[model samples]
Target chain A: MEILMVVVVGVMFTIATYMVLTKSLLRVILGTVLYSHGAHLLILTMGGLGTGAAPLLSTEGPHSDPLPQALVLTAIVISFGVTAFLLVLAYRTYKQHKTDDLDQLRGSSDE
Target chain B: MSNLLILPIILPMLVGTILIFFAKNHSLQRVIAGITAVLLLILAFYLAHEVYYHPQQTMILELGNWSPPFGIVLVADMFATLMVILSSIVGMLCLFFAFKTIETERAKHYFYPFYFFLLTGVNGAFLTGDLFNLFVFFEVMLLSSYVLIVNGGTNYQLRESFKYVVINMIASAFFLVGLAYIYAVTGTLNMADLAEKVGVLEQQGVLNVIAIVFLFVFGAKGALFPLYFWLPNSYYGPPAAVSALFGGLLTKVGIYAIIRTFTLIFTHNTGFTHDIILALAGLTMFFGVLGAVSQFDFKRILSYHIISQVGYMVMGLGIYTQLALAGAIYYIAHHIIVKAALFLFAGATEKITGETSLYKMGGLLRSHPLLGWLFFISAMSLAGIPPLSGFFSKFALILSGIQEERYVIVVVSLLVGLLTLFSMMKIFMYAFWGEQKIPTEKVDKKETMGLLKPIIPLVILTIALGLSAEPIFQFSLGVADQIMDPSNYIDSVLNQD
Candidate 1:
């Protein structure tokens, strides 16, 4: 089961890296999202395959490690915030400059 | 009060949010930002003294009433406190310059908040005791930087800011992934706890891999060679004031983290890790200076120099000796002041000439002697000239390298220093000492208002640090000792409860 999960993550990561290398600004944003998902999976698998339940131990028996779960939760929120900000920035750039092609934007070298 | 720890992080955020509403009234907004910067400077100094006087202690502030591992903790030690002080000083200087530099009306409302939040994130990143919280703080800083970088939505800024945001976001993801694995292996988020746990896991080989993951994360952020492409471009998009603070404080926070984790949590794999780091440091220094020398624009040159200077700090870590670490710390302090001053000087020149290319600028020495000498002092110090702060730092590092008998690295460092001087002289000849050209007409009184005041303290700071090396070196040595021995930090936090 863990091997299968790792394979799935590997494919996701390869695709993400490919997406990130694209020229469109929107594609780069999607690439970031895919890449983070791959990372999140790598973390889960690295912590030996699970025999336990959710991290929260209310009346449940033998809880899973809550620490990684807590970490993942925070990471998700941060990624979400960044993604939203990026989306807005991409929209603003498209609105102001009317293009998402990375090549269209030549930065200042003289200044 | 222990409670004051929250203010440095919180007040700027609150004041920044308030300023957004009054953005239309630019002068009023400037007044508010001015007051906030002064208050932050005072608070930072107080915190620095507090940490210095109480060495070996961790002043942990738990959010709400939660206990360790349950709540986020801000850990203020000598190192973190020192970084906060640097950030505050940069913040004050940059905001002062912002009064004259930032002209995009659309950005006026959001700029202050993003600026404050950027500092909040930087201060938090330095102070957080938990690895996961560190990731959060990294995001806060990155998100704010993204907004500030692209705020005006100019063509140059938008294009470069996209690359900057994407690269940093990927770096943050690596941090989160690294933290997750660390937490899974150790079931602990607290840095002190991880410090103890990771040492025992090195035999498993998993720990070494995790260390590599962390190195990737921080290496990218710190602009270590090969991971530094995004910086010179993204930073070039912002105005001078924003670029100065970013040049001074942002990347150093990444170095601070690498130092903290390597010293505290990942001590088990030094033999495996430091070897790679030593090689990278050599390359980083050589390539970074080469890049700096190739640049013709004033700000672009400074941007490239930031990458080179970061190599010095990393060299201290790679050498991994007590004296070497102290040298790195002192070098960081010196670099922040000098680099910020150089950038501000560039801004001041831009203000005077309405140009950034060194080719288009000359005769500044004839017109503005004060600016010319200030730039010269900063540039020379950056080149590691003796009798200034930079020379003392590199001297200590080189001596420590010789003591360790690492002759190759020592030679590499000496060559880098000479190249650094060449570039510095190039900037001087092109911008300050050449034949006079028709100067840009001086702006009206209101436009250049309050431009030079913010930089005044930074200039004084640069000279003072040079003059007071003995005590400062002693202080950094103390910080190194504290880091090398974790018991003091561990006991202080655990005993506090």
Candidate 2:
């Protein structure tokens, strides 16, 4: 199960990297979202998937490590905030520059 | 009290949140932020005194009364408190400068709130005892900086900040991955606990890899070589006040983290890690000075100099001696003051001449001698001239380097110093000394003095830091002693005393 989770994370990271390399602003935002998800999965899988009851209630035997879950949840919320901010910034950039191609934004103000 | 550890982080957060309601009222925001800045300054000094008097005790505040290795802890030592005080001083000066300079349109967009939020993040990052908490504070700092950087929404700001955000986002992701790996091995996120665990663990291959990952994460943020391409351009886009704040505070936070982690958690394999840091420090200095030498714009030269100065601080860390670490601390404190003052001076010049490119303006010495002299003092200090903060800081670092037989880096450092002086003089000769390019009649003396007023405290502080180098160096030596031995830190956090 851990190996499968690791494989899934690797695939997600690869896809995210490819998307982030694209010139489109939306794609880049999506790429960050996907990348963060991959990281979250990696965290969970690295913590080891335990066959036990949920952490809140009293369990008969061992319980899964709830720390990574808490961490991932916090990370997910933070990334969501960042993604929303990036989308707005991208929208603003699109409106001001009249194009979404990042290549055209290369030159400094001296030009 | 252990609770005092949270004040530096909490106070700014409270003030920033309250300032949101008064966002539309510029005068009110200024008054509130001013008072808050003073209060924070006092609190910082008090905390510093506390740490100074009680050097053996590390103040730990655990949230919700949870024990270490489980609870979130805020740890305050001499080094963290010193950084807090320095940051507050810089924060106050930047606020005053922003009062006179930041446009009303930008102020209305909750600039004061974001400024305070940035401080909260910085102070929190310095104070937090857990790796995950550091990441959260970093995100807080970055999010607020994203707003502050593009506050005016200029085309240049938008263009550059997009790249800045993307790069930082990627770095933050890597930070998470690094944390994940460390947690996987150690089963704990608290830095003190991790130190203990990693010390006991024999196989350090994974730990070393995580250490490099952290190096890259912070190296990018601190503008180290190969990861510093985003800085000069992004920093160039912001208004001068914002630029000053970022230049002074942001990169230093990264360096502080590097120093903290490298000394404490990753000491298991310093032979490998510190060598890498030293090599990078050399490259960072050489390449950064090269970049500075090639720049003609006033702020751009200063921006490149930021990268170069960072190299010196990291070099101190790379050397990893008591004197060297002390020098790094002093260098950080001195660099924060002088760099911010230089940027503010650049703002003043831009205000008068309406230009930032060196060749476009000249002969400011004839009209604004006060501004010219202030710039002269700061520029000289930045270039490591005698009897200034920069000189003593560099002196200690080089002396320690020579003692350690790192002759190559010492030579590179001295050469970088010469090149630094050259670039600074380039700014001086081009912008302040040559013919009056903008015409004297157009210069407003009163307005310029108002702009120069906020810089006066920083200039005096820099001079004082140089003159009183003994006491300060002794203080930093104490801080370095604590950093080199993590037993006290871990003990205090775990309540093992």
The TM-score obtained for chain B by all candidates, in the order given, is: 0.96, 0.98
Residue B451 of model 2, lDDT score:
92
Q: Model 1 off-target regions past 4 Å?
A: A43-58, A106-111, B104-107, B443-450, B495-497
Per-prediction share of native contacts kept: 0.76, 0.58
Q: What docking grade does candidate 1 earn?
A: medium
Inter-residue clash pairs, candidate 2: none
Model 2 C-alpha lDDT per residue in residues B216-279, reported as the tens digit of each score? 9999889999899999999988888889999999999999999999988998777899989999
TM per candidate:
0.95, 0.98
What DockQ would candidate 1 receive versus the native complex? 0.66
lDDT string, candidate 1, B149-210, tens digits? 88777778877787888899888877877876776678787887777677666625777788
DockQ of each: 0.66, 0.78
Candidate 2 regions with alpha-carbon error over 4 angstroms? A109-111
- What's the lDDT for residue B144 in model 2? 95
Residue B26 alpha-carbon offset, candidate 1, angstroms: 2.1
